[model samples]
Target: MHISRRQLIEGSLCGAAAIALKGYAQPSRWQPGTVRHLLPAVSHDRLLLKASFGRPLAAPPTLRAGPRAATGVRLDSSAEFFSFDLAGLEPEHTYELVLEDAAGAPLCDPWPITMFPGPDAAPDRFRLLVYTCAGGHPATVNSDTDSPYFVSIANRRKMLLTGLSYEPDAMIAVGDHVYWDLRSPVGSVMLGNAPEARRLVGAFTRNLPVPGTDNERKLKRVVTPQISDLYGTDFRSTPVYFVQDDHDYFENDEATEEMVTFPPDDFMLRLARATQRLYYPEFLPDANRPAGLPSSGAADRPAGVSESFGTLRFGRLLEIMMYDCRRYMTLTGPVGGFVPETVEEWLMQRMAAEQTRHVVNLPSTPVGWSAGKWGEWYPDLLQPNGELGTARPKYLWQPGWNRQHNRLLQAASAMSGVPLFLSGDLHALGEGRIMRYGDLDFRGNPVVTVLTGPISSGPRAWPSAWRGTPPRTPTGIELEAGLDPLEKNGFSIIDFTEDRVEGQMFNWKMGEPVENLDNLQPFHRFTAARGA
Candidate 1:
């Protein structure tokens, strides 16, 4: 049953006739099809959701979260996006929420979905498929006639489908999910003044998608297809959690100058909120978080706990803390890194709680790697040796950032159970353990960090510190050698039981099974105990 690429062409883009092949073109917005797409599904506690995209006929559409049927809520935007949120659904249970146009025609292709497991149920084992930095600009930017490689795009779609084949309980997208390096605004147009800030903000957003704006339509054209191609039917079945990193939110690792000059209340603030509101799922605002969408409007900004950061508890086996590395201190101008103060406090509190047995922190940035002042780190930290225009960047080795990071290490050490941090951002796959910083006496909790990444992004330059024969860590961390730098284009499949966890990194060859990663090929594996 081998099919050639020529046989899979969808439309004239390849100068080929329409795919008229029923299933291939059946779920497209532009192609003559019955359905357009099944929007990326999201989970909130026990609730599971899915939506459809197509022409909105006169009567409002209806949906069923399995048997719980309700009228669809149309999200007003460039095009109609109807959603169904199935409340009170049992955790760890499966459902197929169907959407029907007024004529009773189902909008989604048949798919089975499961809700996030609840607190009361403790599954003996759970699996996760993790990766990050799969980003590229709009595909249309390529030639109207010539065929573009689309290497990253094709690889990303491949990665997701393969990850799903393992039946991972959830998919953790560790940020850089969407790159904002498209067309950024010029800095000269911005100033601290409200008017100038507004003008600059407008310029920045000219190419971005803002809900309810005409640009949204253009955005859906590019974005919707990407979602459909990458996630396919699995996104509807699994609980996929997205971590919004620098690229997903704004310009590549964007930190606006106006934001620094005027703080969070500036025009850049508005843009941040607007983009978030339109694109992502709803997040319950933490009370410790300030009363703003993007910025706090105050100098004493809270930690990175918002819709972007929260907790996911899985039947007492794991206390999962969501991490948002970019938003914590990126907007304030200072190159300071680490989770916000409030967020740290909350996570520590959770980790030390009586019921907390295993603690898991999922961050966008890799958990290891310290900086030596010469400026290779993105935001140069205060260094003994100066570099990067600003010599006082607050990198991990610097006192401010170091203290915050050390505090996290301290909490992890003091915890009675294993503290595991999983992350992306860096385009390399590796694992390490953070020892208590000697400076922080008695901070000796064993903290483990496993990094998976760059499903379709660049093969990053491995950090000099991590490239040693045995792999190195700045003073406070030690490398876990069995699996270090699975540098090929791949993703990590992690399976966890109550006492131990095993991970395998897999790469796919071109023309491999669309539904599988061909795991029999070159792969890297690692295992660790719950706590040592």
Candidate 2:
């Protein structure tokens, strides 16, 4: 039975009318006819498996592991997400997808998902491409097409596709997947004269414009910009473990205090929520409920909503802790709020339990960018502070809250013996080691922090380098210029094996490798014990 758009529309209207007349209500679990397509069931290759999203929604309409066929497994709700254990799949094989309807009928369309067997068993290597701050431009007075930014992002995406040809495990996008509130003129012709290109860029801006509107035309204009000359589909299908940054919410440095006073107009939040619905695959289950609602029983659950932060574990070797810094952070000036005390406590508890060999903290904001410089600038906002002008202080350059965040970092490093901290948001790629007492004090272990900047956004070079200064704490680590011109926007690929981890920062523009301070040509490799 082919379902046309008109038929689907008619069916939807009829279904709604039927429900209203019969006083039928949505069920806690989805009914067969509620949605057009049901998500595929998933299973992992190993018996010991754990998966989580931010919400209780079903898994994506499709699932991918390795290239092998995955056996159908029952999914159980763990409050945060649906978890599936793949107890009967072959090890070291790529598990493609297994589709099934609510009644367990095979959906018949198979999409391949790649999963790597644990490095614990053999010397297996997997590459992960991490990036952020794409899909929107700042409200600056630049005229040219800034093709470098777009070209760089396209190169990175191409590189990922190239890596996938080699079958890497996953790509971790460390937040800001789509910047919703960037500024661009409406219908303004592109100075570059690429009308189609201009339209694509314009679409992204219109989709989630700042001080948002409910009109569909405006939102569509922002997201599906006129970038036909640049590329098509906006790099949508690249599999990514996405976490939400401040841009995903509305603006930068937005916190509970600022939200209260300058709450996004209802239309803006709605628009943001809609964009999230369209882009992100899954969210934390707890974030599905309305704000301030009790966890156990919520009568008015918002439809198609989810949280953007959580954690996922790959056996006992690796644990990815994705944090929502924007949701809980405080603005820079008056109110000195940081992560809510409760979330902080939860994070601490999670960090204290140290079973994994490596822990990666993915915060939207770079954990340690200096106070003065981070975001792009606009002439309209008045400058407040010194060289670190307070102009547009409300959005970025939030130093006051760093006191609390710094402690959180210290605690995380102290508790978890994890060596690497992966982050994005500075729009520049830089790597540093977190030290203690002004020296290499890694609490009896070695830890390295790798920051990868924006995928497609222009690099704020001068301010980024100025802000890249290491913190001045007694435990402050020395900042060696790992890869100079980190300002050239790009992504970092980290390959992990049982014995060592190799980190490579790829320059998207030149399509080549970047060397660290050690002068290792092409790629930078760091060897450490699995647990150290």
Candidate 3:
């Protein structure tokens, strides 16, 4: 059961040789599963593509336009993964991407990719599929009783594929993409006490080389099953933007008397970075976004890969500014926030600019609701008696986070159009119209906040089941509940246009027939009209 990378390769070669000897056609190294994943993100004239293989490629693969046979440059790569940055592409044009060998033989099947509209070009409509908490393997956590993922990975995949079938223009996956929590107290308890989980997930090594060392192999073993193996090439054609949350760093966001597990340690940061480099495409550069922000344009990162913040611009119609709340979170008392001061300024400026008809603030942490968790913007605390209270200060909750949250909400409410925010990490699907946050009132133009539903969390993982109660409106905020938070495996299809933004939420519960999932339909619907 414990197979080394070299041994796995040797075994694969042996099987391939046997097939060749029996007069069967040999398989291409670029076949699906061998070339583990291909994830691409696009702009009007630029495309960034990332692909990883089961084994290292003997030579760099070429990306070509299937119709015109145009070539794309292969960037410098590491180990088993490579990236491609295709520039000067035509906007709103569809190009068939063909992966080929050195000799020009086709490697994998041709995949068609379309470029987005330019910043100045306004489209009539654009649709997006948004979801969160999509990463987890049932075997890697506690057993059936304690903090278990009640559903199987295959079931989760079906739910995702169902969402994909809706044919949205692009996809936004909010955080908790991977759930291999390691160092935090809860992580330590879940991983240390679960021997079977260790056998299934492998171990995390510290202070080791990133790409070439044995530790890299161990890291691959742990993430492959959760990411590549789970989603495969299902998202290859969709321009997918991934946002990272606390669990993606391999630790739950928690502060304890023993240790503070955020602002990720050097090892945790390296692990998360390496995972992004190997499996997924980072946010491509945007002209309107500053390149000097936290991890954006950092020297250590691959060229054009932005780590902390990104943007999704569909001409002048819609723009989604996505930021990772965990990476740059600071703990300094009243000034500390989930995002840095620079990022906060950038967000406010972007929203105030009113550059697009529909502006969405997408963060990894949800607002307008709380289960009294430590990482939330509100200071509400989950007491021992399973009641939520704000009389006591949270373990390490920063007041600045709430201050920044209110500031953003105020800015959004004052915008010309309806203020909208889509977020995740609470593992539920719901929406709230924030009428007031603290003393700032938005009754005239209530800031609309939404939990975009989770993709992989099972029954045991719901906040109500684990925290002993469901999420509720926090103490300092007054909200009109449009849709109460419901724990299920689901996603949202949001349609953006010049007039209004409409969304349909779809979900399916466990203990039900899996076949029925294929016929799933939107269970809830809501629309936010433009203007007051």
- Which prediction has the highest TM-score against the true structure? 3
Worst 10 residues of 2 by lDDT: 226-235
Stretch of 10 with least lDDT, candidate 3: 9-18
The clash count for each model shown is 6, 41, 0
User: Which rank order by lDDT, best down to worst?
Assistant: 3, 1, 2
What is the descending TM-score order?
A: 3, 1, 2
Residue 429's lDDT in candidate 3? 93
TM-score of 3: 0.90
lDDT of 1 at 386: 31
Model 3 has a clash total of 0
> 2 or 3, which is superior by lDDT?
3
TM-score of each: 0.72, 0.59, 0.90
In model 3, pairs of residues that clash are none
**C-alpha lDDT (0 to 100) for residue 275 of candidate 2:** 45
Which tens-of-lDDT digit does each residue in 161-231 have in candidate 1?
55655667667777765443332332122111124223322333454445566545544543454444444
Which candidate number maximizes lDDT? 3
TM-score of 2: 0.59
Candidate 2 ranges beyond 4 A from true positions:
1-109, 114-127, 136-149, 152-156, 180-217, 224-239, 250-268, 284-306, 332-338, 374-400, 437-447, 459-477, 510-523, 527-532
Identify the runs in model 1 with alpha carbons over 4 angstroms from their true place.
Answer: 1-45, 48-60, 138-150, 182-209, 225-228, 254-280, 283-306, 330-337, 354-356, 370-399, 436-445, 459-480, 508-522
